[model samples]
Target: MAPSRAYVPSILLLRSLLRPLPRQCSLSHRLPSAPSRPKSKTAKSRIRKPDPQPVDFIQRGISDKPGDDVLNESGVSAVEWWEEDASGNERFVSAITNRDELRKHEEQHKRLEAWSRGEEDPNEPEFRNMVIDELKKNPSFSDMQDALEAMKKPLIERIQEGEEVDKEIEAEDEMSKEEGIREAQEFLQNLLEEPSLEHRRDQILEIQAKLTEWNSVDHPEFLEAMARLNEATGGESVEEFQNRLNPYLDIEHTALGSEEEISPQDKAEMEKLAKGIADIHDLLKEGGMDPELEAEFAEMRREIGTDDWATDVFAEDGEIDLDKLERAIAKFDQAELAEAKQEAKDEDDEEDLSPEERANPELKAKIDRIMEDPRLMERLAVIKQILTGTKAFVSNVKSAPDPTTLPLAHMTTLEDQLKIAENDPEHLIALRRLRVNLLPPYNDHPFLRPFNEALRFAYVGANDDVRRVLWRSYLKAKTIPGLIENIPDDAWDILWYSQAVDWASNQNRFNHLKILQKDLASIGRDGPPTQSVGGVDVNEA
Candidate 1:
């Protein structure tokens, strides 16, 4: 029993091998062998001689012979000339050499076919050994054979089905919960469009009861619909109803400790809602709905539902909606507007009186109040200063020339004309600041400063008729009107005057400027004041 020892090379042996590498052979140097053989069986494939060329390329000095010109003008030597051209000949010779392997494969195929058809004994030892060897070479064939046996059962019969489809249906049921919630919300939204609040409330209650059966109380939209339903119940806040429903709403709280008891405020709010709901039912039974009040209430509810009620309150359409306007007005102290109305009403009720009879202590008090207004006085002072200063500046200063006709130096000097403007920094800043609100065609020219200031004063006094002295002073001045008419159309200083007139007209300043008011009446603007500013043609004014 000779024990075979696989030994590693010793350092001396390795060294000897390394030394021999230069002399040759470490472990049989990379072995490559060349074969010389006889091809006598392929005599037809012998190299053929080329036909003689019409012109002797070699004699033409294109040959590689000594003294032959490599730079032949014909360029024939550029090609690889040789004694024999054997390109592509080897491919044919190779095909011919492979015939025996092709014959062996064909014979093997025929033998395999004969065995499969039982023409020969497939059970013979040689054939059995071959089949077994092939199976062993490809183990996947065995797996395929097993699969074929299994496929004997039809696919339809092989499929086992039961719990899988049921589980899928259950998953769909879970996924359809959102769809159900959406349907419920849509139903409630339809109820909101109902004309009768009581009917809407009844439908909402029914829908709410059905929704609870679906156990959709946990959804946000469901909670929101519930709040709306409580509102539709009429006369009740949702909080009040929720307080009454606290025992049920806080049922989840029962699971918590006593520390999580519902707050008293919540209970109070719920109580209020419950009482409101009952009151609404009784009121609906009474059947005398005030259209205006109900409309206003509905509008308030809509506003409360909006995301930006503050901005909506000031919106144009919102301001015009009677319901929203009434509700908004109801929220504020309307004493001022009421006082104005009462005064107007009282004046109308009074018997026709002379101008002396129209005068009273109250009239004097109004004048005193206007005079006492520090804001009014301050505005007047500002207007006076603006007028005086603007007059002085426009009179003394010269206008810039047409820069287009001037050279670069002259244009630069024209720009330097700012020295005159720069001397009045305060005026420039003030005028520029006021320019933002200047009427059209009236830019921030120094000449327009007086008019702008006067208009600003007039606007401030528009709400207080007694404080309109400054407005009248500017409007009634011959110099101002003359300046306005003679001004260029491009200058538009008249726009400010027109604006002041418009402000006065808007404020119904007839009591102060009876002449302008009469003019307005002639023009069909004698009715109550409107929010819109009537267009006043400056030329006509």
Candidate 2:
């Protein structure tokens, strides 16, 4: 029935809350409003109508619009320009047709501006962070990284193993070299113990045969042994043996072997010149003149007699008898020519003589008596065989491969041989020849394992007497041709230190530690110090 007025108002408010809201039209679908005309003082102001545009209507039954189904099926409500959604959010309308494209362009422009300012782009992927994130999420990527680490670990181990193997090989090589040296020494000692020269020669031949079998015919020790055998068998001194082998030993002579030989006439002229110079020196010394002036006067005397000759030439102080001096020189020349001719004749006669005829008559008769005895004849035949064998041994050595072209193993063997023969003066020529040949090439050879091996053989392997000789030779050489000038600083340091240690160990006077300290201090003060040790510059030595 008729309730209170407050109850009626409450009922009406409830009814209003239950009523449905009207559907809103999208801004795109709504008709545009006409623009208002401006007011004029005259009442004749008229509004102009806008031109008509084409209209597109929606088809209901089967829609042809590409995105119509997606929007409808997804239950997306149309948002009007001024209307709010159920969530009470206001809708926005932009003038830009492609707002997303415009936003992308703006972002790109911002990136460009940031780049121009040398600032990192905000959108740029952080590679380290991305890698870390990938490692976290992607098990396969982590596995791949672990695999790479595992591979690297094995590679490092292999390199270390290879280095160890190289060290082992070097040690083995050193051991083998020492063994070979010992064997060679034993062979030499055995040969020395043989009482007879014939037996010694036979032992040397056997050694040579063994060396040939081992492909070490070019071994330095064998060459040296052959040299000694030649000297002994040929009844010659070391100098004579060296002189005979000069054609082979001399680098220049060997290099020039293929060239035209020097004419006998040229040799004779050279001899004459040399003899004349020597005679002039002798004459100067006898006359109490300065020996230093000898060379100057020798040249002058050969061209136009010296002032000393002027004294002998002049009869009066100013008036010189040049014709008489010329006659005397002519006579001297004739005498020299006659003497040379006589010598040549004598040599020819000597060459034509039989061995028995050439010998002293008494010696020849004794030899004949000895020949009658079978025992003596047998001994002579044995001696002849020894001489032949020794000559053959020398020939083999001469014909062997060039030491410079030898393999590292062979070169090492030769070095060992040189060490073995270092104490023997008889092998000096062989040592020098090998040293000269080997030094230049080995000094800078790429394949040389121990770079200073050749230098050690030359300087350290030698005895004290030989070392002194070598130092003297180095000093007197002024320059050794073909020596590598651009030797590494480290190489020089190693060589110098090794030599210093060797010297200190040998000589009781020096304290090696102090010497080393002094050198190190000098090096620190002035880079690569050029201090001298035992009268030799560190670098030069």
Error of 1 at 30 (Å): 37
Error of 1 at 249 (Å): 16
Name the 10 consecutive residues with the lowest summed lDDT in model 2: 251-260
Clashing residue pairs in candidate 2 are none
State the displacement of the C-alpha of residue 382, model 1, in Å, after optimal TM-score superposition: 99
Query: Which sections of candidate 2 miss by over 4 Å?
Result: 1-148, 197-541
Q: Candidate 2's C-alpha lDDT?
A: 0.42
* Candidate 2 structure, TM-score to reference: 0.16
Tens digits of lDDT, candidate 1, 1-541: 9999999999998888878435563323333376335468575355343444523654555454433323233433223212322453322111112335445546767889997787976533345444544444343455575554343233222121213433643454444445445555565555566666655666576766667565643444555666766665654554443323312132121111111122366446434433332333223223333466456455655754653323233222111133343433333224335545766876875687676666466544654554465555443344345346555755876888788988875544322443333224342333233322222233343445654454434332333332343334334331221122222222232223333454412332222233433333432454223323664433332
Which digits, one per residue and each the tens of the lDDT, describe model 2 over residues 1-541? 9776653567778898999977874423444496445677453345434333322333342355335323344344342234465588765532222435445546655655766787843222232233334344443354577655553453345445545655754565455445544554554555556666654667566655666455332355656665667566554443433323211122211111111123366446434433433343333344244443445455545644444443332221122233443333344345446545765776869878887665356533543453365554343344345346555655766467898898866656545665545433334323332322223333344423233344445443544443333333322221222222223344344334443546421331122223333434432433233555454333322
Error of 2 at 158 (Å): 1.7
